[model samples]
Target: MSYNLHQLHAFTTIVSSGSLGRAAALLNVTQPALSRTIKRLEEDVGASLFERHVKGMQLTDIGAALLPHAQLLLREAENAREEIDAMRGLAKGTIKVGAVGSLAAHFLPLAIDRVLGKWGNLHVEIIEGVWDRLAEGLINYEIDLALSTATNDSDGIVAVPDCRWEDNSFVVAAFGHPLRKKPKLTLADTLTARWAIPPKGTAPYEHMRETFLSRNLDMPDIAVQTRSVTVLKSLVAECSFLSWMPEPMYDSESKAGIMGTLPIPGISAARTLTAFRRRDGILPRPAARLLDELRSLTERGMAMQTTR
Candidate 1:
């Protein structure tokens, strides 16, 4: 049975967006048209690709198996177009970058600015989420490159050289939080305090949990669990709630006296942030340049921390 590239792409987009309407919107097509494409593709495959419900679409086992292959095909097709464009000496193309929250806010703009300065015609789409989700986007080709605190290998993805970092020492507590005024701080002192933390199973969550466990203490009270660093930071700043985050995450606020790092020593550890991409493909010049800028930023951050 033969499959159409457009149909496969529609299927992939639907899987990514989780709803027919959203997928159609992303593809700039009508919902009816997207539905027809999926139907035809399902007929060609002889199996239902999704489980449809009133709320959203869920991929079937078959659909799950087909997704990676479809993504690879789509990526190759895109690469072909980009290569041809490059051959014509056009320095224009969109780069999709996935980054974690802090990097998105702190480093992504700087990197984007640098790349845009060199290639004024380039467009960058920034998608921010937890590291795991971003890594999945990189593997699926939904994002061309990812900046995240993850170094574990994903299939068909490679980490660029010297991109890993272990200097993200995070601390918990907010400015004027009573805990900060204590003569001495300990894990037990902060156990009863409400906390905001990353969602479960993420590196930050695991790191915070291990930090508590290593001290032979029970997990602290988790008052809020979310993936958005903006929300986490806001809560920590405006309320007495404690949250854990990298030192760089609050440099500006802390300097403004709007936030404070509690002297809770030994509660934080180094987190590795790495940039990754598909192992088999060559990045277009725009993506390559942005990546170089990100690397340079990481290097500068490390240097600044060393001198502190």
Candidate 2:
């Protein structure tokens, strides 16, 4: 059975507001009317979406499953309206993007600046996370695009082959750290060094692990493991802890002479970065515009590299 936007809106609003009275006030409708909307939607779905309780409405298993689809439908409807408005010469829209910390640090800001310069009315929303979180954002329609390291396993997302580039990862330390003064460095030299890195099973962690394992060396015992970029940087700069990171993530620090990659022999690795989107549907115009800027940026970067 088909459900209308009104019913879905009422359902989602109630989910957000947590109670019928609050949802009714937010929707500017009587509580009875709001209740009728959910009743009709429940009838169409043939499932009890929410369990009534003294505290608030809680989603049943069926409602939990339906929430993502409902949100996706609402987002697409908004995109359609924006697309038509854009066609009518209204250059206003929002671009939602998710990216890993590395790309978010340098690459994405450049593209976003270019896009906003062309369309001043456009808005951008960005969230930083690892690949798993970015993939979830894409699949749930929370983000129109994802910037992350290239991966072979894409369950519900497709990579944009033209929007890919390479960046190098390196073992880094604070500029004045003792390790920086070492005459010569090797992976084995860092085996006993205090380290701060992303948690195990994350892409950064796995890459760091492989860097050691590939050299027939056991992984170093990490002194601190975290996902927060700020915390990682603080530990590295102020605490003299070493960490593995992509160059872009530490570009500003390196430029400021606060931190620099340790000159370890044969320790750097190049990783391919890619842009991705959902497997289905045309990308919204705003997101597409940002993607174009990203492609241009990548091409310009590659050209500069070739010239060098």
Candidate 3:
């Protein structure tokens, strides 16, 4: 009379679909077979699970109480199976990773490589967006983990072990811009320039704006507002717009004659890059290990930097 997982699934399906016939359609089982499973489950509990009416069946109090517990049990089972499969080095599961634009530009592709190298059997998916979308995804269970700068606000997502990463960077512009020729750049110099800005409501963009605010500077009339760092960098190269970015976003265009940087006093523009997941619990091993490799690769990439 003891219930098994299948019985629990059947009962839950009946409650969810509101009728045995509908539940059979949803579960892809014969109506009689599904009805028998529900009957068996109810007998095991020694309680009626549903009361039939004109439209469909309604869960009795015992059934209502069991619903959440049954769902949790099934979820745990799925997680356990994933863990076991991961331990056996068998890949073949889905993980949604949230990546902010700036980091995704440089580090995320490398991180993807490391994930693939380590977990060849697993399929990895990346959800690229700014911090807020990523945070929303994590909260809505749309993403498994997020790589972002602003983990300070969320209580529902857990930051990873050893989550510290840097965001401070030098102000950048095309080569031979007047400030680049100066011995050192001052906060006042920032006012003289047209600046490309990040879209509103993002960590990097907000951090850049905050830097200006902290220095008692007016928001540099955003010469251009864009979500694409690539676009911002291109504008810096081809046109006359200065933008702020973490050093990791720096590249040959930034180093060669195309772009130049000026040292702003007390300006590390320090930002934090962190990984967050469901505060409710741990990731299944496949995702956990993949995440570990990704962070290690990012760490190695960052360690190569000589932080000023």
Candidate 4:
């Protein structure tokens, strides 16, 4: 059972404009055409969506319930059109992008390369911060899209679905340590160990906390907490501390047998990644297209991972 999108559009316009005449004026169609649209929509929905009221047309119970979905559907359809236009080189605009350090270093650059290759003149500004701070920037309207493993959805922000990807992260230590050669590791095994962690409010900190608590363990004793993972990486190389670093970072060191990740049983690599846009405004077309490309790239990456 499918209802026509145009009818829903006409019904929404009539409801919002408060009268058939006003809706017709707003839609740039005649009153008769708009009426036919609503009548067709009501028959398809199997209910009367509005009733004559003193002000104009009042939404009946079914109409009231359906209004939000209708508006959303129409907006999404328009966004799709805009995305098409952008791809065809008919739309132009700037997109401000935000990301934490690692995502800026790893994924976003590749996505931007694809975006610019397609659009030719897509103006993009990159804002760098830790995830929590980047999310705050979004809430404050300082940035348009954020790429991160964690998305703290809040007022005035919407998290885009199907935007997350899996990351098989590692717990790395300098090779000189006694436990470095161990083939297996556990949450309990790492509990008493000193570690360099991102501060408590950021993604890495929360991920570490959640992973431990999920295993029924209390917070591991952290030796240092800082926002910079670059600094933390250098710290891990010379100290006895353990830190969660993505597997790709240690691949070079692993070949030399100077750094390695402990294989923790019952644990696999995973992470939540999301793209955020403002809740209250129109999304610029070019940015939206870039998001689509990013989504496709992420899907392909996940498929390759599954195959391997």
Enumerate residue pairs that collide in model 4. Answer: 168-269
Each prediction's total of clashing residue pairs, residues at least 3 apart in sequence or on different chains, is 0, 0, 2, 1
Better of 1 and 4 by lDDT: 1
C-alpha displacement of 269 in model 2, angstroms?
A: 0.9
**Considering every candidate listed, which one attains the maximal lDDT?**
2
Deviation of model 1 at 243, angstroms:
0.7
lDDT of 3 at 111: 65
Q: TM-score of every model?
A: 0.73, 0.85, 0.68, 0.61
Worst 10 residues of 2 by lDDT: 299-308
Candidate 1 whole-model C-alpha lDDT, 0 to 1: 0.79
- Which is the leading candidate under TM-score? 2
Better of 3 and 4 by TM-score: 3
Per residue, candidate 1 scores C-alpha lDDT tens digits across 88-133 of 7674577789987666756677778888887777788889898778
Task: Report the C-alpha lDDT of model 3 over 1-308, residue by residue, as the tens digit.
Answer: 44499998888788777888898998999988987888888888999988978788998899889886786567657778876776676747666788876567666666677777766777777787777788788776577778877556556766786755665666777776767667766977778688886777766677877887888887667778887767888887778778887766766565566785666678767776778887765576656765786678656765235232
Ordered from best to worst lDDT, the candidate numbers read 2, 1, 4, 3
RMSD of 4: 10.4
| TM-score, candidate number 3 | 0.68
Cand. 3 Cα-lDDT = 0.73
Model 4: per-residue Cα lDDT over 12-83, one tens digit each: 888778999999999999988888888888888889999987779999999999987787677667656756
TM value for model 2: 0.85
Deviating ranges (above 4 Å) for candidate 2: 15-22, 42-67, 85-91, 300-308
Q: What would the per-residue lDDT of candidate 2 be over residues 119-166, giving only the tens digit for each residue?
A: 877899999988888888898788999999888756578999898888
